[model samples]
Target: MKIRVNNDASYIRVFNATANSDKIDVYINDVLVFSDVRYREFVPYTPTFPGDYTVKVYECGNSEKLILEQELTIAGGNVGTLVITGIMPKLMLLAVFEDPNEKTCESNAKFRIAHLSPTTEPIDLTVNGVKMIDEIPFGKRTNYAEVPIGVYDFTIEESNVESEERNDGIRISKKIELKDNKIYTIYLIGDVPDIEIIQSLDIITYMNK
Candidate 1:
């Protein structure tokens, strides 16, 4: 006898001893699908979801019933990538906008930037050995500024320079020569600014206003 089942899950087929045998016993699961037993071969009955199923064959002499069986299953599959959203990080852009009018800090608006660490774990920043802000919120941006004199590279959190990927992070800003007397204003560019949290040392202009 020969039998075959399809992955499409449509149905199962059963066959018997000789090429002429047409009887069959078809079952979807263990339950008999047909009301009557087939002699030579059989065809499946109902439609079903993807899962294991059993098929059986039966032969009855006047006293006992004989049985044959098979198992089957149906299936479907799916796959894709991942996307994420959160707060922004600080970005340092280099720019020279001589506009004296744009000197004040704009508190109403805040921008975000994402800085990647050269190393996985947070870098223990030391500018002559000092501790800065320890927690850098990734994918998010936020900052507050207050400073005086000299160009600063390693950002000072409280008493130290800490490395971070957050808004208050190390950024290569426009090389502004922090002149002793003159004030410089910073402006952002692009629908999507090359950098997010832009900082400028235009204190003289801001104070005069």
Candidate 2:
């Protein structure tokens, strides 16, 4: 799958969410950027100049077999993530970006959900029993929402399920703490009945400067 963005000076990284893929290498404009990236792993953000470029992914050590090729544009002073998702023979690239204009204060945090589970039903995310994100389907990502910095219970439930029938439809339940001025992505990965929740910090490099 290919993705095109408007050009800028950006910080980008790669996440391997392909449940059935082997270790891979990622190249930006033919230059190796991430190598030996295993499933469920993340390659940290790297700086890039503002421009358009090609992104190619290959099975580790096999340049002759191209797995996927995509087009990316670096947005100046922003941060983004390029995700490799889905099973082989039907792989895709998903671009998730942080809004550079949404400023955060020291008393609050920001978070969003990324649904990467290839076979799971559309779902809802509840934080401490309050619905925060709703009806997010496979391969869809939600925009960041601000919340007070604190510990909370996060639950993932199949969307549209009756409240009384939620026991069996619940997919993930976990507790997480959010810190002041931080950003997070809650990733729902793996296949149904065997799902996993991965919480990762999203650092906006341009803001750190």
Candidate 3:
């Protein structure tokens, strides 16, 4: 939370983390104030006449350490865009090849990508620098596929196939960041009904579903 404090007084506010997770530390003006190896979703804390304060969050557990520092400045007045909470830096996106071996998609499967970015609309959902698809079927034949990102270079996948003889046919490639509270989908239609899932990831990281 960002705050603006004036006068020689202290301001009290709630400060909490996921606790016992991202061991957090509190500091004001580069002066260390408090540190907790626990998680508190909304614990209270007081900052003394702060000019510029920061909340440093560090990752704990047997895994690697992830450090995040958020800045806050105090003034006699309120600051604009002072994000209170509910802001996520990263999120998980599920990419599924719907019914890879199903009869509805025996030859080719339709794709429908939806980016649940606060709404049904997307930030940037473009294909081949063209317009967007109105809708895609969910599960039935010629149905749309679901995805997370909007900007897709399906031709990149096409090029991958043309440049090399791929048994799976046309391929697609895209790189987009996933937003929290959003679901992206893709609608696809082809001659082949069955969808074949092929994962060639060099590194496999298991996520705790």
Candidate 4:
């Protein structure tokens, strides 16, 4: 859908996190905005005038069967993500927002985590042995935290699990590099015992248009 550029514009993107859903299409205010989005896929940020909007989701090529309908508000000059989550027959939408204008230290990178896995338990995120976020539940996200630029091991484990039992509780462990002055979000998606992560570099400049 074409939206007129204006000073009060807001930017939004869609992520398909539904583990058991078919490829889908998304409509905002009855206008087709994202189409044929498959599982684990993301639609790039699109601009829209800030206001209340009615969002509808339907299986791709079959709009007659509505999957979900929701109402959401978009504030001016902000960036956000709309995540389609949960398994079939019990789906939902999650809205996560970020302020591009939020100030941060230039020498460090800003990082956050989003828990989108429908079947996973609450999690704790540790980077290089330091706990960055503790006990974050599903369908929630953490506020940005500043970290010194460097490569580090990122680990996600079940919250409240003992270190000795980590072998069974650990969900993901991987190395990721943080670049100076960059903004990032690590999203934990999919169902438990089969969870996956998607790291995103948030570019604030792109939201201005």
Candidate 5:
């Protein structure tokens, strides 16, 4: 099982995405499994025996009040992600099933895009002025695309925008360098105008051998 927090940690805003930004402790089946997990970070693909478990989240040193709790099932050779989201008092847990088998070569980098902005409209992604993906709605993710290691320009635009209104569309742009042999997840999050582009690297240290 893997754990991650995508809660927005942006500067002094009108309201924060999570109840607090302090580190949290994760408990599985009433036992501590992870500690001090910060925002936008994750524990990737940690192995676990197949079984049923209860996942609970609590403030670092206090277990009196649980922020979130959910039932989890770990089947043989299965991979999954436990995501924490929403603001305090309304915090929620989301589980995602992941593909365990990934065919990756050493010559290029692999990347996938995730549209996580709840209030944002579907978007079209372009790389160096070339369209890579179209009409990706919020809360959805795409399959990985392999590309040579190099710097590339990225732009995100509303999917249904008119040609004449392109200049005033909700366009977000950035440039990034992708390293070879690495896997990345580029996610769009937060509300418009204050949105953030998060590029997370997947580092696999061990696998069944």
Candidate 6:
């Protein structure tokens, strides 16, 4: 008789947060993973082996002009994101670990925010005039905030940029409607006065043996 053992794989997604319009190319361990990825966009997650790997980023069709590189580690049965954030000449990398085994909620929605602008100052996140996340620095992420299903106004302001007596620090504002039983990831991209906030729905499904 013969027996075999199998190991589960980890999953990773990419978020492009640069101000440049050049398409991006992402490589993992010398193998091409994502190609021609656009700025201010999020790519769907792809499966990978659980271990350490060399991650590299370059301008599409111009691999000679490499942009960013980092050594990323993935744990078995976990989910994560590889974020290419900040402006050129000072771009940065941030990895986020999401729980793969998290169950879907039926009555509420969960969301998280990531600050990726290298040139922009720290930020404060507010929803419906109420401060939600404060003093978020570049390459940092806020914990998931749960909210009831509904629509609300979302705003991001530059922290300490203006006096506390005024709201002149406002950077960007938008309206978002949350659906029940869903998860979301929002990314803040680009340089000051020209920023973009992109949102993506996150779907988690485990592979069966």
Error of 5 at 83 (Å): 2.1
* Model 4 lDDT tens row, 13-92: 99899988889999989988889999999899887688898999999988797999999888786577899998887889
RMSD values, in order shown: 29.9, 4.7, 18.2, 3.4, 7.7, 4.8
- The lDDT for every candidate, in the order shown, is 0.29, 0.82, 0.32, 0.83, 0.66, 0.75
- lDDT per residue for candidate 3 within 1-209, as digits (tens), equals 22333455443343331212345544444444555544323233344453666654434332234354666565532211111121233311112222212111222222434222211111222455553543322221223433443434542222223335644553334544323222223322121222211111100011111
Q: For candidate 1, what is the total of clashing residue pairs?
A: 18
Better of 1 and 3 by TM-score: 3
- List model 6 lDDT by residue over 18-89, tens digit each: 786489998888888889899876788777778988988988977787888889777776677788876786
Clashing residue pairs, candidate 4?
Answer: none
TM-score of 2: 0.87
How far out, in Å, is residue 104 in model 2?
Answer: 2.4
| Cα displacement (Å) at residue 16, model 1 | 5.9
Q: Identify the runs in model 1 with alpha carbons over 4 angstroms from their true place.
A: 1-22, 35-45, 60-64, 76-209
Ranking by lDDT: 4, 2, 6, 5, 3, 1
| Pairs of residues clashing in candidate 6 | none
TM-score of each: 0.23, 0.87, 0.28, 0.89, 0.74, 0.87
Better of 4 and 5 by TM-score: 4
- By summed lDDT, which 10 consecutive residues of candidate 1 come out lowest? 78-87
Better of 1 and 2 by TM-score: 2
Candidate that scores best on TM-score: 4
Lowest summed lDDT over 10 consecutive residues: which window, candidate 6? Answer: 1-10
> Model 4, 20: alpha-carbon shift in Å?
1.7
What lDDT is reached at residue 82 by model 4? 90
